[model samples]
Target chain A: MREAALSLFSRHGYAAVSMRQIAKEVGVQAGALYNYTPDKQTLLFELMRSHMDDLLSARAATGDSGQDAMARLEAFTRFHIHFHSQRPDEVFIAYMELRNLTPENFEVIEGLRRQYENGLEDILSAGQSDGVFAVSDTKIAAMAVIAMLTGVNTWFQEGGRLSLEEVEQIYWDMVRKSVAANP
Target chain B: MREAALSLFSRHGYAAVSMRQIAKEVGVQAGALYNYTPDKQTLLFELMRSHMDDLLSARAATGDSGQDAMARLEAFTRFHIHFHSQRPDEVFIAYMELRNLTPENFEVIEGLRRQYENGLEDILSAGQSDGVFAVSDTKIAAMAVIAMLTGVNTWFQEGGRLSLEEVEQIYWDMVRKSVAANP
Candidate 1:
């Protein structure tokens, strides 16, 4: 049911989709959806929360925090691009449907997003302390890197001119230098 | 009329906004809007194209292409951030409403976007030639830098911790370092 809602929401913005449409897409009665989610707002909030939960858990599973900041940062870069690439629909909803979320829901989702961003900021801070990263502001740098890495989804295709491996290396190279200590 | 349409489209996804609603917002009869545009899709295309046209013209007005590559890039980084900062609605519609554009309109908007991107890519290529930048792929580098700069719109608020000038400088620092030749 959530999957159908996600597809519909991503295809037609959340405002254009409805419980009935989602229910129909799921091949069930609209009333049945209420059995699962109280309303569309709750459904949207849950979808976003689930995505964030998945992201944080996956980041935790990376288990490379003990490594030096450079290595850890590289892992994050690759992981982010790979994870987002596979979930284009979710990623689209996560960003595009943000405005549709209720205020309280927006805050909760923003908090989770901030939590994810802090994962990168922490690495940048550690690298700065180690005299390896020359980042002027760890928080800003984290956001900048994240936006750049995720931008890959806008144009990247599986069988395009460059393989994902190649693309990842290219981005990793830029990411490494973007925060490296000035020579 | 376009203003009202842009506002509505950005606030509510393009799919959800009706022509009648746009007309009401613009203080006109619904039929009156047809005198200005053939339909809602054309209205959207016009808004998007106008925004891109404004961007390209503004970019041209920056008039720093004659400068050294590094200086030119800094100008672009600041210009992009500043220009986008002032037009949050257009920026939002431009990104969010792309999926709603007719296929032909999408191609046209995309081509204009590529033209703007090529502006930055040309600078990166020049920088690489001058040995001031070490970007492995100018195309990818351009996209990365633009994405990073525009991401400022997602969080930056006026009277916040950083002034626009300060934010520009911070992003310029990261962008400059991101493509600087490895020492």
Candidate 2:
């Protein structure tokens, strides 16, 4: 049911999708949806929050321990690629429909986003301190890397010539070289 | 008039912005908007298409001729960043409201997008042939570079910590190193 709502919200913008359409997609009366979500705004907030939580928890469980900064960054890159590909609709909704979130909800999601971004920044800072990375601006570099990785969701299609793993390797290689200490 | 529409569309989305609201924003009767556009779909299409056309023409006039591949790439990057920053609403509408375009109109914009992507690919290919660039996948690299440039539309603000020129320089540095022939 949430999947149906996500697809509808992602395909059409969140404001254009209604509880009636979501109910129709789920083959239930619109009134029944109220049992799950109080209103359209609530639904949007829940979907976005859930998706961010999933991303954060997944990254935490991936365990960056014992890996060099480069290795950890590569792992994070691959994980982001894999997770987004698996749930493209949710990822798209999370990104494109963010403005639909209420101010309170927006801040919650934004905080989670900052935390996720800070994880990458932490790695970059660690790499710089350890003489493994050379970047003029860690903040900008982190943003750039996240932008490059999240972009996979915009263009990636399953069953294309390159598998998700192959795409991850290619991106990881580009990212590593882009900020490498020697490069 | 168009500025009001663009801001509303950017915030509420193209589909949700009614002709009545647009007319109100423009301080005209609802029926008066029909004198300008046949329908909401046409308004959205024109907003996106004209912006893309402007981008293409601006890039073409930037006079990247006689420059090496790296120099040309840098010039293109700077132009893209500057143009996108100046007209973020148009850029946002072009990306987010694309699905609202009729099939025929969508094809026209898609063709323009392909041309833009091909420009990057062409530069990468030239650099590779001349032994000045190394990339594992020209197609993916082209998409990645465009994505990175287009991302400015999402987060960039006029009075943000980084100036437009500074942001472009940082991105250019990353992009050049990402596809540089040698580390």
Candidate 3:
């Protein structure tokens, strides 16, 4: 049911998708769907929450804390690109459907998002302290780096001019230089 | 009517907004809207096309060609952040409503977008030739730089921690370093 809702919401924006439509996609009655999800709003919130949860858990599993700041930053860059690229639908909805989320739900999702961002900011802050990175603001740098990496999904295709590995390297190079104390 | 449609589309995704709602927002009958746009699809395409045209024309008006590559890049960076910051509705719709556009309309809008991106790519290429920037791939670099700059819209606010000017400067610094031959 979640898969059906996600695919529908991704193809059509959240506001445009209906519970009945999701039910049809899942081969269930609309009434039966309500048992699983109280309403469309809850469904949307669940999808977004799960996405963030998955992201945070995956990030935690990277064991990046054991590495130094520079290594952790590189791991973050590559991991972000790889993780987000594989889930274009979720990424799209996570961004495009933010406005559709109720104010309370929005706050929850934003909190989760900030937690993930703080992971990167910690790396930047550590690097800054160690004199390895020269970022003006670690918070802003975290946002900037995520934005640049997430952008890979906008135009990247598997068989495009560059492989994901090559693209990651190119971006890793730019990202490394963007914060390096001495490039 | 265009204003009403843009607002409605921005608040509710294009597929969810009805012509009737747009007409109501404009204080007109639903039938009256057809006189301006034959259908919602046309209205969406017009909104997107007009945004791209406005962006490209504004970019052209900057007249960055006379400047050196480094100066042109700065101009482009500051210009993009400023122009996009002023038009959140258009920027949001331009990025989010892309999936709703018909293929033909998508191609047209995409062409205009590419023209704008190509302008930045030209600057990056120029910098590469002049040995001022050490970017690996100018096209990817252009995309990366653009993604980083446009990201200002995601978190920037009027009374936030930094003024837009300060934010622009910070981003310019990152951008300049990201591509600079020596940082």
Pick the DockQ winner. Answer: 3
Q: Where does the lowest 10-residue lDDT sum fall in candidate 2 chain B? A: B88-97
RMSD of 1: 1.0
Candidate 2 residue-wise lDDT, B50-150, digit = tens: 88788889988997878899888898889878888888778777877777888999999999988988888988888888888899999899888878777
- Ranking according to DockQ, highest score first: 3, 1, 2
C-alpha lDDT score of every prediction, in listed order: 0.93, 0.86, 0.93
Candidate 3 chain A weakest lDDT stretch, 10 residues: A61-70
- Encode model 1's per-residue lDDT on B1-183: one tens digit a residue: 999998999889899999999999999999999999999999999999999999999999889956999899999999999999999999988988899999999999999999999999999999899999998899999999999999999999999999999999999999999998853
Local accuracy of candidate 3 as per-residue lDDT tens digits, B1-183:
999999999998899999989999999999988888899999999999999999998998989877899999999999999999999999999998899899999999999999989999999999899999999899999999999988888889999889999999999999999999987
- Which candidate, 1 or 3, would have the higher TM-score against the true structure? 3
Q: What is the DockQ of candidate 2?
A: 0.70
- Which residue pairs show collisions in model 2? none
DockQ of each: 0.76, 0.70, 0.88
User: Candidate 1: where are CA atoms >4 Å away?
Assistant: none
Alpha-carbon error at B163 in model 1, in Å?
A: 0.1
Candidate 2 C-alpha lDDT tens digits along A14-125: 9998899999999999999999988988888888888989999999999998889888888888887888889877877777788788889899999998999899999999
Clash pairs, candidate 3, are none
lDDT of 3 at B178: 96
